[model samples]
Target: MATAGKDTTDASGGPGNTATPAIRHSKPPVNHHRAPRAATYSTSILPFERSPNGNILAAFCRAAYWTQGRAVWGALTASGDTKHCYKMDHARRGRAIIINNETFHHDLYLGQRTGTDRDAENMESLLSELGFDITARKNCTAAEMKSMLVEAARESQGDADCFVCVILSHGDDGAVYGTDESVKVEDLVAPIKACKSLAGKPKLFFIQACRGKFVDGGVEVVDSKGKHGQDDEEEMESDEVAVQTIPVEADFLMAYSVAQGYYSWRNREQGSWFVQAVVKVVRDNWRRMDLLTMMTRVSHKVAYDFESNVPSNRFLHMKKQIPCITSMLTKDLYFTPKV
Candidate 1:
């Protein structure tokens, strides 16, 4: 996130003007947490309840969606490779919210996620390497998630440059499993946006869950390293607002692992396709490529390189997935951690 990609105008890596990017689904309002919230890093355990619906492999690409913050958000870890990263203080990089829900009411849930913890572990390692102070938790209920987001935003000290949140759980389009129940993507955004402390700051949300129950049946094609759809330039839609006014919810970037209404893929032991692609791209091209470019590469990796090997015939068609990103950033973003 070295603010190097400010010039990006391509749909894949640019400041988009969509007033409110339309997502595949929406959730009911999350009643803002009224109680005094606990510090994000406290030793307190997450309160829990149980039962659910959502989907299979919805949490498959939670790590895959870890884009939307600084263009090279994780490049802080690659400081040995980038000279500019050493110019900024690494301690001020900011905070990240990592929610990995693996356990649920077995009788009521579809199935237990056997490999999600691996994704969470790998994610924490990558984020830490990149310089984020992480507030990680597991098996949280819907209410806790809402309260957590509000607190995360409110407690975000003004000195930090950005905020990040990653949710890895069972989900259905704009909704994710909260151990005992499901919550909407919009509900999560509303409270964080309501917090005045984080206004005007770049915030990113990376969601790894199923948007719907669909699969991509790929057609045979010769392999090539060519850019897939560079020529198609669609005009951006814009809406004017009052001058100098910052909407309560501006400067957010959302990176979803799989496209809406489709299944996400992950290995039982290695981790998710999206997460792996992101780590590889940012690690190898930290300075040469910006975060937006890395995210586009992530989509390409998931869409073309990986394929599912689930034994069931029902899962055969789930051989591919495409990552999605939506942004409302108004300025350039970078990850220039001080030496």
Candidate 2:
């Protein structure tokens, strides 16, 4: 869910031949419990099911939609802040398919004041009611996010199971922000390991954006009780649980919000904060929780519901912003459910 500017073109869009760059070397550490594995660590766990349309699983769209090998793709803000014309709908689940390329916030840059077309229509109605399949391309090109991940890895031909991509643009170190343009997430995830039908699956990339410099503090205040609003569970036991699946050399997971340089928050109005704390902890814990404990309860509610005041500005005023999770998940992915 990270995207900002634009410019790097390829796939006939012209300009340095759509840039592929190639930065593969970096996939060797993930044991994720061996279930058609693929390496990635720091806390990765995706593989949940249930929700064919009713009974419950609606909050964030998840009917499974084909989970055989998993297949999801997102390009979100290729280089557009907003032009708007979205799409996202899913309902299969047997083989896993969720793609909601969200693109909202069309033109402004750095100063942002609300425009990305209602933040790309609320990220296409919140990942299509949490199901995802937003029809693809709200703002694309890195040759269309590498030709839609090589056509969702050739329609997951070789039994595609796991491969997710979520980029919500506006970054720095390494790069991301394409809406007029700015690319390089290693040129759109190094061509998904030369897609042999997504080679060995398990290729997740859930980044939010901002990896530069903007600090006044680290942000880590805690002190809450209940009533004001509740959703407790501050670690009863599960602290670390990355199992590792394919990455003896294949699988991959890249979840980022900050920690390269720093600074990830966008609220010209109401968006950003690691994607509203990752869709409010996956719509209040996808049935119970397990995407690394719902992204560590969205990194502890974005480190205690955010704070970086500087209102009076005597010299700099407010800044503080902390949000980081560089996990490369390998296993222990309960996939959240079981309530």
Candidate 3:
């Protein structure tokens, strides 16, 4: 039951050395079918900055919810009778929403890990550490991701302050590829907006899947001479607690590995770029920075550290992705112990 500073090798004959596969272009099977709408809104843009006080604990908890409990090689390996060991819930100040659909069909990719119990055990340990009540399942259909989204949102209302979802599997633009099915992105995101207690607070989604198959040719573009002053100012001025707006689109953030219609990278050995960056940043800076600032560093680290070494020794490139902020937060949040 080691909680702090422990290392245990995965039973897979030591740790998994195979890297999670990087996203590649593939056409989603055409069905000409659409999913039912729960609710929807346009993504908003906001400036990013560092928080004056560090609140790594809160940030870590949120990220934990989205990560489906898979983190650093063996950070939270626990054993024995532990009920509610695998559910996502809020910590000291906020609540969480978790969505995980690992099991898919007998596809060429995503089957082994998604269908195994190892993945669930890994996530259970991670969530337990953060005091989250986790809900996880294997081999869910595409319709399941959407249904779970609605249920998770409804469950978080009374106690939880924030909402978070972590999706693991194949995906396409504005949609997620479930086992033998595809669920629109709107199906997952819209339900939270429809919920009341979960509304207005931060709705965070961490998607670890391919978005599209089309790789873009290298192109040169002009770098804008825009000053980064405004971001800094906003960073410093945030001291009030933020909430949602009338349209229920005030406070939210979506962290995607690749842009729309692109692929996200992963290794059979190292998980995925977005997941690694998230754990690395939290492990390194959670005690010193706010969530937004910490994620910015993660965005930079993932975009740079991950390199595609397959497909003829050519490095697959990902565009510069910023940790998008759709802030309705009025006050500053710090996970650091207050002095």
Return the top candidate by TM-score: 1
| Candidate 2 structure quality by residue, lDDT tens digits, 199-263 | 53456666666666544354333553111111211100000111211222345656676555666
| Stretches of model 2 off by over 4 angstroms after superposition | 1-19, 23-25, 29-148, 155-160, 171-176, 182-222, 225-289, 303-306, 309-339
Order the candidate numbers by lDDT, best to worst: 1, 3, 2
The residue-level lDDT of candidate 3 at 300 comes to 63
Model 3, TM vs. native: 0.55
After superposition of all CA atoms, the RMSD between model 2 and the true structure is: 19.3
When 1 and 3 are scored with lDDT, the better candidate is 1
Worst 10-residue lDDT window for candidate 1 reads 1-10
Off by over 4 Å in 1: 1-91, 224-249, 311-318
Residue 114 of candidate 3: its Cα lDDT? 25
User: Relative to the true structure, how large is the alpha-carbon lDDT of every model?
Assistant: 0.57, 0.43, 0.45
- Model 2 has an lDDT value of 0.43
